[model samples]
Structures are given as structure tokens and as C-alpha cells.
Target: MQICGGGRYDNLIGLFSEDKGKDVQNKNVPAVGFAYGFDRVIEALKMQNLSPEFENRKILITFVSDEFKDYCVKVVKELRERNITADLDITDRKVRKAMEYANNKYKYVIIVGKKEVEENKVTLRDMESGEQKFLGVEEIKFE
Candidate 1:
């Protein structure tokens, strides 16, 4: 069974023929690539009964008002760009209710309010630690 297969420099001449001149010489390019048997790996791990540290990881963002909805979208986009599992509350819930929901549903809660928007900052609360920190919008690192 091929456990993995890969190529590093695949010369996709035919695919880019429109861009390549008709008389373009065929060049042999160096290439490498690979893929793991995910199902097999999962079965092996299951047999060993190994558990990961964090099985459920998620972040929740709550916007205090419609005016800050755009900012909420921006924050969610930033988190997603960093490969973080994040969701924004778009139910038009009150700040307190949204915060309560987030505290119950996610490990982290990012609160963005009108004041925060005006100040260009966001408040990050650790649901498990109950610790909070205010970070400038520009200071928040996505990646």
C-alpha cells in the first residue's frame, strides 16, 4: 500500500499551455508530495485509546450592538485566517445574554462593543480561567 505519495516540482505544461508558447520545450521539473492514511491512523490511535488534551476547542465572539457587527465580522475573519475555530453571535442578543451564552459554550469569549470600536480595542476573556485582558485592535495578533 502506498502510505504517501508526493511531488515537489510538477511541470504542469498542458495545464498552462495557453500561457506557455506553443514551441515551449518540455522541461522535467523536480517535484515531491505525500498523503497519510487518515482512517488507518485513526483506527490505530483508537486501538491504543489515546486521548487528546483538547477535544473540544472553540472561540465565541459577541457584539454588543448592531453598530459593532462589522467589527465582529472582522474579528471572526481574523481568527479564521489564523486557523482558530471561532464563531460570532448574530442573534441580536443583549450583551449580557450573549456573554452568558458564550461563557457556557466556548473556551474563550471576545467581546466587542461600541466603546471598544471607538477605542480600537477588544476584550478577551478566558472562560476557564475567568481572566480578562483588554487588547488594542492593532495589538491583537491573529497568527
Candidate 2:
């Protein structure tokens, strides 16, 4: 096990007054320190088959019709450029199937349709809460 510990000793400088041959500090000095032996902790957790959960924001850009496909693709590209974990269907899947797939894997779903494309906005849906709202592309904080 990678057992480790650490501390600071400010007054410890004064204990070294006998400098052997060279002149050194004989007064207390301010100090601080810390150490991490998390390798051991991680090893123990691994032995128990324990794992940490990671939360990732997932967004799927879905379109209702083929006409909106181009717009959805554009929006998806923009989101990805902003470092968002966003994707869209390239197989021209039906809206129902697209939504089902999104709900299974994504935390958010952005629906692009004729109206949304014309309005330059999208219907952002929260998969977990089933709540949705219209949002401008600039308003989406994927980063």
C-alpha cells in the first residue's frame, strides 16, 4: 500500500541553530505542506470493485423532417465546436425513434423543425425532467 503522510514545521528552523560549518537560519519561519497517497486509496477501491461515477452532459440534435436535417446538422456542429457532447441522426430516423434513442443515451434533446429553423431557435428538452423550452443557439451553454 502507498501509505503516505505530510506536515509542516515552521518553528523547526530554530532547532538547527548549530549549522555545522555554514551560517543558516536560527529563527522560526512560516511554512506549509501536504501530501496525497490517493494511489493506495484507488487501489483499495479497485480491489473492492468500486468505481466512481462521472457525470457528463449529453445533447442530441434531432430533426422532425428531412428538410430540417441540414439545420440540425449545422446546430450539432456548432455545439460540438463549443465542446459539447452533441450528436444527431444521419440515417433519417423517424422522430419517435430518434427521441427514444436520445432519451436512452442523452441528458438533453434539441429538436429542430421548420418553425425552429425559421426562428433560428431549438426546443431544448431535459430528458430527466421531461421539461422543454425554446432557446436560441447562443443561449445554449454546452461548454
Candidate 3:
């Protein structure tokens, strides 16, 4: 019969303790916490027809030069490992033309260039929403 379950903090003991230094004793000692059942939330949303069916849309990872081709391959491999639909510009088009092709073909674009490779980062741009984010090379994990 678990109607609800959550965590709480009991700071009364810490608040009343006097043996510790006055500076430590005077610290703010309010308790705080939260609880959530994601499964229940999903069920509720489904009942309301508000749950979105996640779709795997294609993304394009464009490389501007032969120098960055290997890095581009690595990024493509990482994206695919995450089950993300992705492709690369094997055509070796110019930067502007590649961007054009990506915009037309994919929902999102991951741009990797010489300077980006040197800086160990990549730029991700959403074609439809026009939003963008720059991610550090190491920060991106496939899984």
C-alpha cells in the first residue's frame, strides 16, 4: 500500500548540536528533497494522449577537408552507436555546398572543421528549429 514514496531530511539534531564551532552551528539547516515515478508519469501522459512517440530522424555530419575526414568518421560512428540516424559528406563538397546539402537532407547538422578539430569541439545546428550548440569533443559520448 505505498500510495507515495519520497525522501526527507531531519536536521533537528544538527540544529540543536552545540559542541561544534559557532560558525558551523549557525549554518542554514533547512531540509529539502523531491520524488518522482517516471513510469507513472508516462502512463498518465499516455492516458491523456500527450506522450510523444520518439522518432529517429536523420542527421548529417559534414566534414570540410581531408584533414578532418578521420575525425568526422569517428563522430559518425559515435552517433550511429547511440542509434541516431546519421550520414557523412563522402562527396567532399566545399563548406558552403556541404552545409546546403546537409540543410536539405537532414534534420540536424554536426559541423566539424579544421579549427574545430584543433579546438577539440564540434558545432551542432538544428535545421528546422535553427537552434545550435557547441559540444566539447570529449563531452560527446555515443551511449
Off by over 4 Å in 3: 1-56, 137-143
Check candidate 2 and list the clashing pairs.
none
Model 2, 24-68: lDDT tens per residue?
554657676767677777666667766432124578888888888
Q: TM-score per candidate, in order?
A: 0.56, 0.59, 0.54
Judge candidate 2 against the unseen true structure and give its global Cα lDDT, from 0 to 1: 0.77
lDDT of each: 0.72, 0.77, 0.71
Candidate 3 similarity to native, TM-score: 0.54
Worst 10 residues of 1 by lDDT: 48-57
Q: Which prediction has the highest TM-score against the true structure?
A: 2
Which regions in candidate 2 have their CA more than 4 angstroms from the true location? Answer: 1-55
Cα TM-score of candidate 2: 0.59
lDDT tens digits, residues 54-130, model 1? Answer: 22447788887788989888888877776567888999788788778876778778888877788877898878898
The per-residue C-alpha lDDT of model 1 at residue 20 equals: 67
> For every model in order, what is the number of clashing pairs?
11, 0, 0
Greater-lDDT candidate between 1 and 3: 1
Q: Per lDDT, what order, best first?
A: 2, 1, 3
